[model samples]
Each structure stands twice: as C-alpha cells, then as structure tokens.
Target: MNPQSADAGDRTTGRYKQKREAILNAAARLFDENGIKGTMLSEVAQQVGLSTNSITYYFKKKEDLVFECLMHTTSTISAIAAESAAGATPEERVTRFVTGRWKKLAEAAEGQYPAMMSFRDVGELDASYTKTIFSAYGDMFRRVRGLLAQGPVTSDNRMSLTIRTHLLLTSTQWTRTWLSNFSVTDYGRLAAYMCDVLINGLLAPGKPWAPTALDEKVAAIKLPEPSNRNFIAAAISLLNEVGYNGASIDRISARLSVTKGSFYHHIPSKDDLFAECVSRTLAVVEGMQAAAIAGEGSGGDKLAALARSLVGFHFSPRGPLLRMTAWTELSNLEQFYGQVQPMRQLTQTVVDFLATGMMDGSVRPTHQAIAAWMVVGAINGSATLDKWVPGSEKTDAVELYLKPFFCGICSE
Candidate 1:
C-alpha cells in the first residue's frame, strides 16, 4: 500500500477509537443519571454528537452499548477492589478500598473517569447480557468480602463477610448520592470518615444496643393515597423488583390481576407512581423515627429500633421500602410531588438520631452526617436480605445484618 493510504487508515482507526470511548463515557453518565431503563441510546448518541444511525456503526443496538457500558463499569470497580486487596489488615483494606474508589469518583466528578454506576438494574437486562453482568458482580462481591476475612472460614464469619461486604459496597455507593455535597478535595477525608464508621461503628462504648419497642405503633402503610392503597402496594412491589421504568403499567395491573384501566384509574401517571412509592418509603422511615424519638431512650435505642423495624418491614406485607436506588430518581419525583425532598429528610433524620445519641452518651462522637450515610447505606443494602441471603426468613437481621453497622463490623 502507498504510505499516504496507510497513514489515512491509521488516522481513521484512531478517530474511531476516540469516538467509541467518548460514546461509552457519555452513555455511562447518562445511564447513571437517568438509569439503565430510563436512558435511550439515541440520547447517548446525541450526547456524543453522533446521529443515532451513526451510533450503530459502533454498537449495532442499544443493548450492545449498554452491555459494553456495564462491562466497562464492572471492570473499573473490580480493578479498584483488586488494588485495595493489597492492604495488610482488614481495616486497612477497607479504608484503602473506600479511599481508592472515591478518588476514582473524584476523577469522575472532574470528568476523569466514567461515572460510577449503580447496579440497580443489573437484573433489568435480558438473560444473555445479565448472566455476564451478574457473574462479574459476584466476583467483585467476593473480592470485597475477602477484605473482611480475618482468619478461619467459618459460617459465622462467612455470614459477617457476606453481610459486611454488601454493607461496605452499598455505603460506598451511597456516597455518590450525598458525596456530591462535598468538594472533590474533601472526598479523601470523607472516605476516611466512612471507614471509621464501618470499622468502629456508631455505638458509644458501654452503651448496649437495647432498642426498646415503639411507644405508639405505626399502622400498616396505605400509600399513594388512601383510597388506592392496594394498587399502590402492587406498584411498589413492581418498582422494587424492576425499577421506575421497568415497572410498566402492564406489570402493575398484572400483579394485581387487574386491567390496565385499573392502573390508570388508580394511578394518574408513572411519575405519580414513583412519587407514591417514595412517599410510602419516607412515611415508613419517618413513622419509625417519630415513634423512636417520642419514646424515652438514648440515641442508640431510637436508631436500633428504627433500623431493625425498617429492615424487618421488608419481610412484612408492606415491605421492601422503595429500594435505595429509587433515590436516584429524586429530582423527577420531587418535581412530580412538588418540593418535598424526602431523601434529604431521610438522611437528616438519621443524623438527628446519631447526634442525639452522641449527646446522651449512647453513641460515639463520630462524623454524624457521614455516619448517618453509612447507616442509610447499610440499611438500604440489608433490605435486600430476602434476595441476597438464603433463608432470609430465618436470618436474624438485627443480629447478623444490623450488628455489623450498629456495632463495628470487625468488633468481637
């Protein structure tokens, strides 16, 4: 071939590679912001200045692009977990993992890396794509769990490791939700603070985790609006299983063995449906908090009661509490319901509990807000108890699940 022809071919290849990375970057960001079910490939194409048809040159279909994007995200996290494995101690490993991950997040915030993903819709993909995604996630889960393994591999430690691994992962992931509140420079400090909460826990020494029963019991939740409570429950079930977009009108109606007309009759729109699900979640959380606060107990009592009740509620008929990933759609839900930021209120309520505990000598003097985020993260992750653990029915969530966060994950 002539030199000029070869040189032109090389230039074309380089440009193609650049655009492909650009597409992946843009798609990842869109997926994170709008969710996998919510983002359109054409939107990704538009973000990268390519025509939708032009995108097909790189990815023949939207799922191809989504699979690649998810794979790219999985690889990024696996690499971090691998590196974090080098720490000599479990706490050090935990600290390094959180710090390194956030540094990448700092970079992502500064456009240095693809936006870190929320694995909420890993199940939303088709069987062919999800098999690979779930496998990658499983490996990553093991790697993080390895960070917590101290010695002999007993079922007890296995339980703790499994529980703590999810706790650590979800809490760190939850950081992306609230961490934006801080500057990129503050991420490292915040990561350290998070590690402290995970390792040392929130309980002040000598303060037993004696969560008293609620003074005034919360009535079973009837949501969206009172008149359409059953319909809202079905909708919440679908939202928890699928997602906002995946919870189609068809599925909601079918879950209740009703017609689409019924869904529309009971629920006005999908946006309203999401608002109702979120509203129900906040109501449950706030109900527990209010009951806890009204009782005469240390901060520890209020928090323990709140955490245990919320987690157990998932197993209850009204359960599953709107999944933490639902918070990503906060802005849209807020618009639908007007300016009541239920998520912010949720975090602040935990902060109030932690602060109260610290004052009353029931909880340690830690970074109250960050510690609250850990609680939020751990509890959010634990809500998947039925799915993640075998015989989640038999599992004492307060002991096996909640203990890691309430008492230190590493404590004896």
Candidate 2:
C-alpha cells in the first residue's frame, strides 16, 4: 500500500477508538446514576451525540457495553496496583496504590469515565463473560492483599487479610458516590487524607482503646422481636435479591410462606413496609451510636465499638435488612423522606463523634466529615462480608474488618 493510504487508515482507526471510548464513558455515567436496568442504549447515544445504531456498531449488545465498561475499570485498577509493585516497603506500596487510584479516579471524573463503575448487573451477562470479569476483579483483589501481607501491619491469618482488603477496596469504591456530589479541586490532598485515615486511623497515638462491653441490654436493641420481625426480614431479603421495584408485597409474602392477606395484616402497604424497614435499620444504628457514645471510653473507642456493632449486625438474621435498607431506593416511595431523616441524623452523629475525638485528641486531626463518610460507607459495604468470606466468626470478622480503618496496618 502507498504511504498516504496507510497513514489515512491509521487516522481512521484512531478516531474509531476515541468514539468507542466516548460511548463507554457515557454509558458508565448513566449506569451509575440510573442503574443498568434503568438505563437505555439510546440515552447513552444521546449523551455521546451519536445514534443507537452507532453504539451498536461498536458494542453489538447492551450487555457487551456494560461488560467492557466493568472490565475497563477493573483493568485500570489492576494496572494501578501493578504500578506500585516497585515500592521499597509494604507501607509505601499500599499508600502509593491507594493514592494513585484516587488521583486517576479524580482525573477520570472530569471526562467521560465516571469515578465509579458498577458491576451490579454482571450476573446477567453470559457465563464465560462473567467469569472473565470476576477473574479480573480477583486479580486486583489479590494484588492488594499481597501488598498488605508484605506490609508489617497485616497478619498471616486468611480471615484478617480478606477483611482488611475488602474494607480498604470498598471504602475507595464508595468514594464514587461521594465524588459525584462534591467537587474535588485537589486529588492529591484528597488521596493523602484518605490514605492517612485508612493507614493510620482517626485515632490519635497513645490514646487508650478498649472494646465496648456487649451485654443483653445492648443486644436487645436490635430489630423488633420475632413476631413482627418476619415481615421486615423477608422484605429486606427480597429487596437485596430483587431491588426495590421487584420486591413487591406478594413476593415478600411468598418468601415468608404467608398469604397476601396475612401480609396486609402485618404491614399496611409496600411503601409502609419499606418505611418500617428503614425505621428499624435506623433504630438499630442509633442504638449502636447511643451505646458507643454512652460508654466511658475515648472517642476512638466509641468509633471502634460502633464499627464492630454494625459489622456484627451484618452477620445476624436481620443483617440483610440493615444492608438492604442502606442501599434501598427510598426516593421513589411516597412519604419516605420522613423515614430518611434518621439517616441524616446518623451522619450528624458520626460527624459529631469524629469531631469529639478530634477535640479530645483521641482521633487524628483530619477532615471529620469525609472520615465520617468513609466510616459509614465501610459499614454499609459490609453487607457482602458473608459472601466474601463464608463462615467467618462474628467476633473475628468484626475485628479484622475494622482493623484497617481504626488501628491501620502501620499502627498495628
């Protein structure tokens, strides 16, 4: 071929790749905002100023596009982890790994690639494709876990490694939601603070730490007793399994092995039932907060107690309800705002506690708001702990899970 012809072909290939990336980036944003089930191909095209046919030209199916987007994210994260492999020490490697990813995510936020990617619909893809995607994720997880193991703070125990890695990774993952609402001007500062908190914890050095005593009174402050608990428990399970719209009263009743009339007898309406679930979740959370604050330990101790209590609840029978409610679509339901007030209150409670710790020099002098957000996000993300590490003992699980955020690897 002539030199001119070859050059023209190269330029065309470059344009195609650029356009394809644009589509994927737009699709990621839409998927994050509306969820995969809620987004349409046409919407993605509209965002990219292209046609649905053009999108199909690049990605033959919606599933293909979604899979590629997720792969792109996991691959990018893996690359970030690999980049830090040359660090001289485990602490340096872990810090660089997290900080680098945060900077990349912050930069990506300014363009088509949203800071966060969703794999919520990965199970809906082809078996082979799902395996490939999960393999990529596993690689990333292993790399981080390996780095943590190399560090001085991590343990030889498999459970400890698994819990710490999950907490660190998921805390970062949840930052996507945070970045969406807030504008970040300095990625370096943000990354440094996050790394510091996770690595060194919010606790000040030399502060006394003690486990909060768990007694019958504290344990009883959970969800309603068994008689009326079935309704909320079943609803939470269904919600986690099938989301908000799919978790209808009838399905919940079927799951509970009760008649529709019996369901109505226990709960007034689906919305009402959801509100009650939300209320119960808040109640349990508040109960933990109250207990933690009322304790005679330092503020850092209170935070640790709160983290342990929340994680323990995740392993309980009512854990699914708490987890599901945290991620539920309450905005679509009527009169749900009233129920959501407690969530805001919970945030305030966290903020106040962190501030108290800071004031008392029990916690580090960092951004209390962001630290609080990370704490709450970690707790909510623990909903998958059982699936992540099956048969993990409750006490051991809580200790390992909260270790990274509270004591950190360096401190330990």
Candidate 3:
C-alpha cells in the first residue's frame, strides 16, 4: 500500500468510527430520557457538547436523529444478545435471551423508551427506517430459533417453532404494559415457570394439540356478536384504561358517554364484547404477520421482520385492549387459550423451525419439546414482567437474560 493511501485509510477508519459511535451514543441517551417528541436537536447536541448545526450535519433531520438513536439502543441490545448466545449451551442461551430482554425492558422503563417509540408510528415514519428496525428484531428471533431447532426437530417443524417463539416473545412484551402489581423479577419467574410447562407439553412424545378437539370446542361455544363497531370501540377504550377483567360492560358503556341501553342495542353480554376485542386484536396480529412474511427477505430475513412487527404490535396502544382481554379471558382458560392461540402460535413456529434445522443438520437434536416450551414460557413470562416491576428494576434488558436458557437447549 502507498504511504498516503495507508494514511488516508487509517484516518477514515479511526476518527470516523469514533465520531459516529459518539453521535449515536449521545442520541440514544437523550432519546431514551426525553423521548422523540420531548427531546430537540439542541438538547442532544448540548449533551454531546456539540452545536445544533454540528449535530444536524451528522443526522440531517430530527427524525434521522431519532432513528439513529433508536438504532443505537437496539443495536446495543443486539450486541448483548449475540455475545450471550455465543459458545453457550442450549439452556444457557435460553436463559441469557430471557435475562437480556428483561434488562432491555428495565432500561426502557427507566428511560421510558417505549414512550418515545409511541411518539410516532414507526412504519409510517419511513420505509427504510422501519426496515432497519424490523431487521434487528428478525435477527434476534432467527438466532433463538436456530438454537432451539437442534435434535428431533425437522425442517418443517423449525418453521413452526420459529413462529411460536416469536409469539411468546411478543406476548411477554404485551403483558408488561398492564402489569400493575407484578415485579420485573416476578415476570422472569413466570417466564421460567411457563418454560417448564411448555417443555413438558412439547417433549411429551406426541402432538399435544388436536385440531379435531379444537374444532369441536369451538363449535360447542356460542360465538359473540362483534359486528357492532360502536360496542367494539367502547370495549377497546375501557380495556385500554383499566385492563381486561377490570373493564365491565357497564364501564365500557359509561365511557362512551351513553346509556346501558345503547350498549345492549349492539351487544348482549360482556362475553360478546370480549369476543369482539379478541377478534379485532387477532386481526391486527394477522396483518402484522402477513406483512412480515410478504416483506422483502428469505426465511431468516422474514423471521427478523416478524419479530419487530410483533414487538410493535404488542407495545402499540391500539392493541392494549386485546392485551387486557387476554388477562381477563384467563378465567375462561379453555376459551382463553382457544382465543389467544394466536398469541401462543409463535411457540409452534419456533418448534417447526427447529425441525427444519434438524433436517438441514444445522441445529442439534438434544431435546425438542424441552427447547420449544422453554422458549415460549420464558417469553410469555418476560412479556408481563414490566407491568409488575417498578422503579429502577424495570427496563428493556429483560429479553437479554433469557438467552442462556436457549443456549442450554441448542445443539453444538
């Protein structure tokens, strides 16, 4: 290499890297603390000891700065996940993933990062911007699936497992939103418990779910009337405020500033309103899944896209009603499970993905059912941890801690 060329290359690699990292770090800290809307360019620049013009030189627009900050925060999370997943056992990996995510949630809660994300609709902001976020999410899920797909799982099963795991992760986030009394640690414990049950159910030697049984069950129950949009709106608003069981038909009607007569005109029972909420929530989830599958990418790529979509869906205010319903519906376990199956579907997807990995000889075959359930259980538990955990303990790092458990189940 020529001396001048080498000198130029060194300069390009050294100072540029440092500056970029500094800018991103500054952005992440400010955005996390003040939120997208609350923080201005001047604020971020002031913290970095740079002029507003200088910060704008690097980020160009306010949205660019916000996106960059989000990217940095999520990238830090991705790096932690990657490090934890490296050279670890399946169980270890699962634990790390779970724990790591919990930590992330803690950061978010302390900094109110989700509040920042809520400031704007991510996808509507920009196509490329959304794609970057989705890519980060999909990458994490694919990594988890790869670890779980070892052993008796075949290629086809791997796909299912991938999806299922995604669902569990998303559900964990969803639960965090309304958790009033539970601590973040309690959510982690819940993740562990659910993982245990899931492992038992999946590794039980045969298929636990029977479509015939499901169909019969569905047929036996009377479906609720969800066609009334006004009733649906009332239910959504009420659930959004007080949560699932707490939201009654009377409360919903009152919120609408209307009479119980109006509520009855549209729906007959509380069960009917709940059914409507579930259906609407399911529709939203389905739309997100479809977008993930349809977006540009292969299976692995799509997996990442799906993860962000699910995360966004779970945390978004629009779906809070359904989340509230999820808690209330637990009283009707059979009906609840029947309705929330979509929520749990990510478990099946992860299992299916593991099966695929087994066929391709890319994943180990140590314990299929065990791995699958652990992923779901931990994910589900983590989703609800944020709601219960208060103060400094609740952040976004919850996802990171669960990775090790995944490692323990992964094949070498």
Candidate 4:
C-alpha cells in the first residue's frame, strides 16, 4: 500500500472509533432513561446526529448494541474490582473497589455506562450470547464475594454472601437514576459515604445489635383489600416475571384462572392493572413505615422493624410485588408517575428513620439521604429470596437477609 493511502485509512479508522463510542454513549443514556426495550436505533442515531443506516453500520442491531454496552460496563467494573483487590486490608479493598467503580462510571460521558440492565429478554438472544453475558455477571459476583469475604464479616455462609453482594451491587447500580443529578465534585464523597454505610452500617459502635421487638398486633397489620384484588395480584405476578411489555392481558387472566372477560370486567386495562399493583405494594410499605414510626425504640430500631417487615413480605404469597418494584419493571410502567408519591413517601420514611437514629446516636453519623436509599435498595434486592434460597423457612430468610445491613459485620 502507498504511504499516503495507509495514513488516510488510519484517520478514517480513528473517526469510526469516535463515532462508535458516541453511539454507545447515547444508547446507554437512552436505555437508562427509556429502558432497553423502549429505546430505538433511530433515536440513538438521532442523538448522535447520524442517520439510522450509518448507526447500523457500526452496531447492526439493537441487541448487538445492548450486548456491547452491557459487556463494556461489566468489563470495566471487573477490571476495577481486580485492581482494588490489591488493597492491604479487606476494608481498604472494599472501599477502593466501591469508590473506584463509581468514580470511573461518573467520569464516563453522560450515560456511557449501562448501569442497570434488564434480563427479561435474555432468552430471546442467541444461546451463546446469553451464556456469555451471564458468565460475565458471574465473574463480577465472584470478585465481589471475594472482597466481601476479606472484610470483617465472620459468617462465610453462601446465603450471607449472596445477600450482601446483591445489596452492594444494587445500591451502586441505582446511581444511574441519580448520578447525573450530582455534580462531579460530589461523586467521591457520595461513593465513600455509600461504601461506609454498606460496610459499617448505620449502627454506632457499642450499640448492641438486637432485633427490634415488634408487637404482634402492629406487625400483623395487612394491606387493605382493594376491589378486584385477585386480578391485580395476578397481574403483579405476571409483570414481575415477564416485565411490563411481556405481561399481556390474556396471560394475566390465565394466571388467575379467569377468562379475558373476567379480567376486563374487574380491570379496565393493563396500565390500570400495573398502577394498582404498584399501589398495592406501596400500601404495604406505607403500613410498615407507619408501624415503625409509631412503635419503635430508636431510629435504628424503627429501621430494623421496617427491614424485617419487608423481608418477611417477600416470603408471603404476595411476594411477587416485591420484584415488580424493581427499577427495571417500574421504569416501564405507564403509570409510573402515579406511584411516585408513594415511592417518595417510602424513601422519606427511611430517611426520617435514619435521621432519628443519627440524632439519637444509635446510627453512625453519615449522609442520611444516601443511607436511606441504600437501605431501600437492600430491601428491594431481597425480592430475590426465592431464587437465592429456595425452600428456606421465612424466619431464617428474614434473619439472614437483614443481618448484614442492620448489623454490620465488624465486631465491637
């Protein structure tokens, strides 16, 4: 090849790489804003100021783009985890791993990291691609488990590790919803604060980690039965399993052992059903929060009560709503805004409980707002209880799930 031609080819290659990066960045933001299934290739191209054909020239399909975006995030975080593993102490290693990962994600061009991925359609992908993506996730989990084991936690039980790791990852990944709102200067402090709360918890040293004693009557409070409750429950289960787009009216009706006419008789539409499902979950949470507020020993005590209640709910028949509340599913619902008040109320309930703990010196002095979200994230992750420890007794599940969060692993 001639020297000039080779140089020209190199320039074209560099430009192509830049454009590809831009597309990925735009796709990540769109996926985060409007879910993987909701985003279109044309929107991605528009965001990059390129034609759809030009964008397709780089990523051939949306799944291909999603696969690459997910791979990019997992690989980047895995690399960071590997680097942080070199820290001299377990605490140091965990801090470094958590903060380093967040800092790198924050540094990316807006929405460049595929922060939260929905696995609902993984079955639709080629078998090999599905396996590859899951394998990558397994690698990331293994690295996190290793770091967690090195910490002050005494229990090496598989269940403990699973819960802790899920909580940690969930809390960090949720930043995709809030990270852009934060200034760059706040990233380091926010990351460090989250790590501290996850590692050390809200409990102050010398505070005994006793489970809060709940009055049987208060603890027994239940969600008020709504009209067409059975249909809503059925819809919740379907939505939890298959997500908003995949859950159809016929399927929801089938799950209830009812005809399509029966479903429509009780529920007007799928959107209305989704809204009711979220309303039901929020109602349960609200009842728990109210109980905690009215009948607690301290802020920490109230928080424990709330956490225990949530964990226990996941083992009940209505447990599927716990999964439905996950950001992936919730983001897809047309009635998301309708649930916003309840969601914020639940968060504020946590924040208020944590703040009370801090004031009373029962909880550690830290950022209450962030700590509250971490607590909620941990509770949300508990929806995996059935998958994580199938057939386990509810009492054992609740204890194992809440232990790490309410009571830190470090010994006094």
Q: Please give the lDDT score at residue 218 for candidate 2.
A: 45
Query: Each prediction's TM-score against the native?
Result: 0.86, 0.84, 0.40, 0.84
- Tens-digit per-residue lDDT, 216-271, candidate 4: 43357766777687777666656655556557787777888889897888888887
Query: Once superposed on the true structure, which residue ranges of model 3 sit more than 4 Å away at CA?
Result: 1-62, 87-89, 107-121, 151-155, 178-220, 223-412
Candidate 1 lDDT score at position 213? 47
Candidate numbers sorted by lDDT from highest down: 1, 2, 4, 3
Candidate 1 lDDT by residue in tens digits, 28-104: 77777777778887899899898988887777777777787778777887888899889888888888888888888
lDDT of each: 0.74, 0.70, 0.49, 0.69
lDDT of 2 by residue, 1-412 (tens): 1112123444468677777778778888777665666678999999989988877777877878888788888888888788877787767877888888877776677773444475544554677677888888888878877667654433446567767777777777777756755665766777887887787777787764446463233445644554677788777666654456557677788899999999898788887787777777878877877777666665666776677777777667566535533343344644666666667676677788788888877888888878888888787767666545555645466666776677775443
Candidate 4 or 3, higher lDDT = 4
A best-first ranking of the candidates according to their TM-score comes to 1, 4, 2, 3
Error of 2 at 380 (Å): 1.1
Candidate 2 deviant stretches above 4 angstroms: 1-12, 112-116, 151-156, 180-182, 214-223, 226-228, 238-273, 324-335, 393-395, 410-412
